[model samples]
Target: MTVRNRDFYKGIIKKMLTERLTKYEEDGYKYSLQYNSCTNSYCLYYTCPGEKHWDGCAAVEASEV
Candidate 1:
């Protein structure tokens, strides 16, 4: 995707995580951002409460992470 799109997504994720959310919930997704990211990937990751693996990452590539 274009940089503008990437930035837009990043901003949204940042807002969701920082403001919209109050606390972590089971199966409920949160947002995350990586600055100066080396991955060069817009793919997001997550951990569900009590989960050992991030196999259930909250990735959205909807133009979703």
Candidate 2:
């Protein structure tokens, strides 16, 4: 899928996101779907609330080709 527009990525991530895969919630956000430029993929990441870093766990990713 050639996802060039913002809406397409948003829909994919929102649909594929599974709450069971996320953890950590101390203050703010708990889940995120980040775009990896090197791999050209989207990865689901979890972090402690208010923090913007990965929680040291392997992420679930989907490549775009």
Candidate 3:
């Protein structure tokens, strides 16, 4: 994956997170958005350089925090 692809995925994730965060805020839920990122090392069949993906993205839940 080229820089363009990496950026594209990042943008997508950002948008998704932003939308979700906005919803949470609108619902009067206070929380922090936290995400765990990891690379796809096991799926080597379609590996691309500089390509990264995000997983385990979740909110910290203000109540829990």
Candidate 4:
């Protein structure tokens, strides 16, 4: 779908990612979706409640995720 408005696209991505992340956490996958402009895609990076570094585990695209 073509999103003419930038904010609208951001909102949709945020909403969908939030839901997906919540489901991931509930499913026992300790990964969180982080937005990366450099990669230009949403990915599941390893994240802990108080940890950093993403554990070197790259985030995958939502479709592949």
Per-model TM-score, in order, reads 0.30, 0.32, 0.28, 0.34
Please list all clashing residue pairs in model 2, or write none if there are none. Answer: none
Instruction: Rank the candidate models, highest lDDT first.
Output: 2, 4, 1, 3
- Model 1: per-residue Cα lDDT over 1-65, one tens digit each: 11224564455565655665533333343434333345434444444445555533233443433
What is the lDDT of every predicted structure here? 0.43, 0.47, 0.32, 0.46
* Poorly placed runs, candidate 3 (over 4 Å): 1-4, 21-34, 37-65
Off by over 4 Å in 4: 1-24, 47-56, 61-65
Candidate 2 achieves a global lDDT of 0.47
lDDT of 2 by residue, 2-50 (tens): 1135554344365555443323342354545565777666665555545
Mind giving the per-residue lDDT tens digits that candidate 4 earns over 1-65? 12134443344346557576432332232455566777666644444445544543444444443
RMSD of 2: 11.6
lDDT of 3 by residue, 1-65 (tens): 22234343344435546576422221222223344335311111122323343222332222222
Instruction: Rate residue 58 of model 2 by lDDT.
Output: 31
Q: How close is candidate 4 to the true structure, as a TM-score?
A: 0.34
Cα shift from native, residue 46, model 2 (Å): 1.0
